[model samples]
Target chain A: MQLITVAGPPSSGKTSVILKLIEAMQIAASDVGVVKFDCLTSFDHLRYEERGIRVETGFSGKLCPDHFFVSNIEAAVEWGQNAGFKYLITESAGLCNRCSPYIHGIMAICVIDNLAGINTPRKIGPMLKMADIVVVTKGDIVSQAEREVFAFNIRQVNTAVQVIFVNGINGQGATILASHAAKARSIQTLRDLKLRFTTPAAVCSYCTGEIRIGNEYQMGTMKRMEFKKP
Target chain B: MNDTDILYMVLTVPVGEIMEKHPVCQNFFKNLRIEDIERGLPLHQALEKADPETLSEFGLDRHAIQREFCDFLNVFAGRSDATGPEITSITIIGGHGKAGDPENCQITINRGETISIVGPTGSGKSRLLADIECLANCDTPTGRKVLIDEQNLDDERRIELQGRLVAQLSQNMNFVIDLTVNDFLKMHAGSRHSINIDDTVERCFVCANSLAGEAFGLDTRLTQLSGGQSRALMIADTAFMSTSPIVLIDEIENAGIDRRQAIELLASRDKIVFISTHDPLLALGANRRLIIKNGRISRVITTSEEEKACLSEIERLDARLFQIRKKLRNGEIISRNALG
Candidate 1:
């Protein structure tokens, strides 16, 4: 099955872009399935089910969404294969901008809206840096000059990646994104696959449910801010 | 043969032989409403033999008609690429957008055509022109490749080819050279090895003056030319002196030149003209217009015959505006009725 992963900040139109891509692909609902990974509650699977497409939604709850995504993505791939899906898509809301759930050989997309300021491409961290394609959403809402400037900023962060403009509301550029996404090399399993970037690290005292907010409570993998001397 | 020889031959030869040899000349004849040339009569004789009523009906003089026919031949021959490899079309391969998205657009512009690039400000119109100007082979930031004759040129070939293919008149054009206009034209004509230097100089000078708002003497320094004057000067220079086959003009609408004639002059000389314009007249007048969005060509619209039919009305309106501009320059007060 072709593996496609969509990662972006919240409300950047990742789910909408995925929906448009699925529609543009014109595949049978039974042949494709989506695995939605978000932080808290997500009703996106209902949207997918409403379209008669199979979808599995997993919430990380208090855990980092991307960490949960990386850990269970293999199972998601296995589920998709058992379901006889020709295309398997996984989406992660890269909440912290610290991680993106991309595999070594899969089609990775980072969706960011034009409303996210001109410097957003650089601020999004590896989520923008490691993707094979960066789809800019909400192009219809901005001026042509603003769009050009936004695209220029993305080029500054990652020079090798392809930049595309998509209007998620009307699904204007979905077919093009789908065609690029369809070119993902098929993989039988994610067991031997490697992550494009290591997921956000750190197992601090908060991990063990310490609930303390003191510097003394701060533990593993923590960096303290250094104030200039008075 | 050179243009003069061809012109002489066409004028001296029988109209039947000229038509049979160059079938394309039929278009010129048809446009001028010159029908029913006798089998034995030459083109000069055919026009002379025609009644004055027919010539006046088409609003064409005999000598001007012959010159126009020659101009048509020159443009037709340029499209045929009589000299070397045929650059029949300009193909722009898909390139990524600014946001690292793949721009899945393939645009091919044929020779002897006028195209307009239109979009809102900061839409990368100039950037697209730059891509074509450099003949980018995925090395530019946009990763757009411009192909000539549908083949991508390597870096070495692009470097070697250089400015031989495209002569672009950018928005901010300043001539820093210290030479007089007469000296500059003579120098260019000298470099191009023109057979009739005086004739070319006169043609270029008159063409520039006709296009510009105010006329400047040939002895005027190049740096002393105004924005409109310099723009007009380059338009004339690009038409007469520049050897490049492709021409790119950025924002010519505000250049204060005779827009239609400027385009026609270049196009008639076998130059492929691409103008980045915001004016509806220039855009609609083009054979095709590319809509640029977010630094990529979002769409290409070929000017339909129906769209072309609207141009005459636009041209008329533009002419009215031109008159008002003239009156305003003469310090005439703007009366309410004069707005029409």
Candidate 2:
């Protein structure tokens, strides 16, 4: 089962988009699983239905939603895989992205409200970097040029990423968004790449040198020629 | 490369030259801005004997060596930044030395993750660690307070902080409540900062052929447990249950239960764990070590990056001590064969 997380700032229409996506998948003859992490209220199935989707909630803990949420997501995905479902969508609680563990083996989609550029970096930069794709919701509110600039800024932080502009309320670009998530064979590649990029450079054992490139012997001076590329 | 190449490298290469030349060998010497190799050659020659990698079969490349040095320096930098009493210098106002002087003694704890305060009877190792602990608690005569991440803890918060934030496992391994194994874990699971008790408890018996809950009955009481069993339970509780950022352990093998459990515990994680002990096995488990003489911390010796760098030395000494100790305990079972 492929796990897809719909994460975004508060009131970014994550729940609305998730329901719309779930409804679209069900209509397309694909069984889907959904899990909403309620950090405040205990998990309630009735509350989930009231919010407009079939789900299980009420897992209690002090841990950030991402930590425990991922576990619950994995368990739900296992069930979905056994039940022959095509996808499982997890809607996370709105919080700063740094507290959460980067989910491995799953696609991360950051849903943003298109009308605002001020909240772009502050609310979304770190989370967008974690995402394989950025979904700009409320596409009808923002002009075509504004959407292009938002996508461009996201590309500056993360060079290679797919950005989908969708209006989930009216079902505009909803099929395209689901298609991109379905095509995300494995998100582990992006996660692993980020780890290598963030980790500090390895220090040289001899002479306590911080060698960035070339072989150790040939690192600094012209005399030494042999240096291994890491 | 194979074992023979590794062996040849160790036998043929001078430690200092290897240390200097191996890590981007050309760049290292080049960055020094030296015209002649002979000018800065002495330091490498002196370090020739100190080359950490000895086995030729290991085939550790220059990159690995450089990585280790960086890790070593980073550990030191972390210790300095934390600047807890365990790594700091301490002064004992009065403690008589058997071989030497008697008053105003200073010792520097300068190695590994632990600062083992050791000396003969009345040598005041306990007094030193106690003073450091007290200092860590902000109990100095100058009324200085210890703040973790700039948050000042009051008396009640300090006690709570001491129990939950900083776990201190003294020589006495006694629990007041006669709690069942499951009940004890359940209680601690609440107190734990962020460690998943379910994951850790399950991890303990992951290797067992049988189920953890079934193999080790959850109803087992603390008092009914054997020395090794109690040590394992407590170690698991301390390491997994408590969320204490800093762990202060006094003489882990003081009563000599099963030290392998404690050794394994120390080997994991990047937490600020400080243990005081004369046991070489426990001391050697540290990444950064400190030698505490009298009330002052003396030399700090940080181990190199090789996994189990201090293992051989500690293991050799421990083996000798264990042999001598084996005579005292009549047919003592060191390792317990269990399903749990």
Candidate 3:
């Protein structure tokens, strides 16, 4: 089964896009499955269930959902395969701005809202730069000029990626998104699946639950941010 | 000779000083100038240079003394090791928590009982865990007083007890120490006074790998471990090596490890396990659950038989999820057959 990872910041219409894509894919008579990964709790799995598609949900609790999603993507694929699905779509709760859940050989889609500031695309880490497709949502809320600027900003970060302006609610651009997911390749081995970007170095003592505040006890790859004197 | 004997001897007096103070060994030291004796030679080395015949004449075997002295120095040079305490019960008395109602809350937890604390975000669940951890007595922000066995715990006693009272396994488990996995486990085992450090460390690694989604080698550096691997290691270590009777976990269900087995492993060890969670599977797994609303203990409910029945269904769903998770990690496709 082909795998498609849909990732973006919270409320970037990831589920809406997936739902519309699933509806479009059903029109073509292709079987689909979904796995939703979230940090706390989620209701997206219910939407897939309502559509009568095979679906599973995982809550990462206090852990990083992106890492959790990557670790469990295989099982999701197997579940889809057992049901004879042609495509398996996975959605990750992109809590960490720097984390990239996309894997090589899969159709990695990064959805961004036009209202999330034009600089958001630039601020996004490998998740945006490495994505095969960048879907700009909430175009209805922004003007034509603002939408163009948002798309332009995304291009500045990833010149090679295909940028699509999608209205997730009305099913606009869902056909193209569905076609890309349908044609995506499945990775044969995890070794073949490479990350497009490097992970941010873990340097915070708080990362290890170290409550003490001081540079002497701080360890790992740490960077100090200097404040400008006013 | 035993380690304690060596410790006693070295700590009591220097070997050169001991020899000098004793009249019986004065002649033996005569061959060595007073200046040489006065110049501090390590006790073990000073004993090494003494003549065997002379030592024998004084009713002391030179080789035996040298071996004993070496053993003593080894013990002296090694880091100190300690064991955890045997905690029977924990009691929490009411104080005004940051978010919880100011009403005093009174609750007591006993050994071998698993309790889950559930609340919305910023509901003071962690504050309660912290109160239990610190054995607090009105000093913390929550104003919650913790008692070990119906009596208020002394702050000094809490400091002296080490990991005997609580061993916390928080959400983030990053290993800052730059050591091999085997070396890290070995060090932990050594500190716990394991009889066979190597064997214990091996057991820990095996147990950790069983819980972790990915299998890691003993040669892997601690710093290189992923979030799931580190959590698995910490769980295994806490279950086997840690002497802490009460295990406070912020959340174990998040990192893609086998959460069910991790909880079962800790619970089976007769520990008082308290987990703060948002998942129903983990919440219902506990014998009792403390519902935290606005930071106070709004209500405590025992797991009803109906809930226990629901747990079986939840377990089935959780098991299916776990199977899919495992297959996914192995680079397998999710087929309909995988649901079975």
Candidate 4:
């Protein structure tokens, strides 16, 4: 099955983009399954179910949703295959800006809204940088000039990635996305698919449930943030 | 020569050479005794007759000194220096919370009870967990007051006994350290003053494997571990090694480990468990569920027997999903019939 990972910041229209793509794929006679990964609770699965699509939801309560998604990805793929689906689409919880849920040899899409800000592309970590396609959502709300500038900022960070402007509410540009996903080459050898970007190094003591605050007892990969004097 | 000359020569001779030259000298060196060529008593008897002060000056108490050294070594190796506090319960008083409505709420959680907080995103479910972690006394944004055994805990004591009072497991379980799994556990075990470090490390491994889908060896670097494995390791370490009386879990549903087993492990240890989650399985698993809205506690619902019964159905569905996931990871094609 063709696996597509949809990731972006919260309320960046990831779900809307996926929904529109699913609709377009359905019209083209493609069977698809969805796995929604959220940090706490999610109602996205219900929407998929209402459409009579096979869907499963995972809540990564105290765990990073990306990590949770990777752990259960195989199970999701199996579920998709069991249902004879042509595509398996996953929606990740956009909690950690630094984390990238994309895997190698898969169609990785990162959705961002024009309203998020033009510089959002620069601020977003690897999720936007490593995506194969950057889908600009809420394009209908922004002026053509604003859309151009947002697209330009995205290209500045990732020169090779394809940028697609989509209005998920009315299914604009979804046909192109669905066709690209449906016709994309399947991964030749899934044996050693690695993530496109390295996960941000986990150096903070908080990462390990450490409660003490001090430099002496701290151990691990640590980063210090510096504030410039105004 | 006189007897004094003989005595002086015996005392001046190096002990090693003297023992080698005169095998009898090995036992008789306690004090100098002139050889009476023909009438001298045996060396052993001669040493017995020597003065105690002379023996002491000759450094003949080597055996006693060696014994003391061994005793000191034992003391150094056998003692456990680590200690932790034993808390019985955690009580939340009717302090005003900083969420949807500014209302006072009170809840007392005893050891071995599991409580879950549920709310929409940005609704303050996490705020309550934070208040408890900080041992708030209406001073923080949430205006929640936390007590240990129905007594207010001071800030100094809280700082002094941070990890002992509560161990929080947040959503991120990333390891920044480059050490191997074996080294990481060893460091934790040493800090905790574990009596049997090797045994504790082994137990942690077994427990982590039980919760994680994939098995990782002790030699695997912490950075190389998958997300689920890291979470599993932390959970096992907290449940088994940490002496904390309360465990605050941000969410474990997406951690890729066995969420149910992890919860059961912590609760079985008599820890007062507070989990903030949006998952139904976790919410229903708790004895009581606190609903959070806007940033305050709106209602508290005790899990009904009907919900408990529904949990089994949920578990079954979860297991089915897990099985399918496993098969897919193994590079097998899934068929509709396989789901059955």
lDDT of 1: 0.76
lDDT of 3 by residue, A81-134 (tens): 777777778888746777788876678899888878755786775678679999
lDDT (CA) for every model shown?
0.76, 0.48, 0.70, 0.69
Top lDDT prediction, candidate number: 1
Stretches off by above 4 angstroms in model 3 are A1-230, B1-8, B11-82, B97-100, B162-164, B330-340
- Give a tens-digit lDDT track for model 1, residues A1-230: 98899899988998889888887677888999999998877878888899888999888998887779888999999999999999998888737876778888888999999878755776676688778999998765543324544664565455557677665765655655665777888988878788877776668888778887898888897756679999
Q: What fraction of native interface contacts is shared by candidate 4?
A: 0.00
lDDT score for residue B56 of model 1? 55
**lDDT, residue A40, model 1:** 79
Q: How well does candidate 2 match the true structure in TM-score terms?
A: 0.33
Off by over 4 Å in 2: A1-230, B1-115, B121-124, B131-164, B191-200, B204-217, B254-261, B264-267, B303-340
Q: By TM-score, is 1 or 2 better?
A: 1
Clashes of each: 8, 48, 23, 16
Q: iRMS of each prediction in angstroms?
A: 23.0, 27.2, 30.2, 28.9
Report, in order, each candidate's fnat: 0.00, 0.00, 0.00, 0.00
Model 2 lDDT per residue over B120-144, tens place: 4444454444333333432322122
Docking class of 4: incorrect
DockQ top scorer? 2
Deviation (Å) of B3 in candidate 1: 49
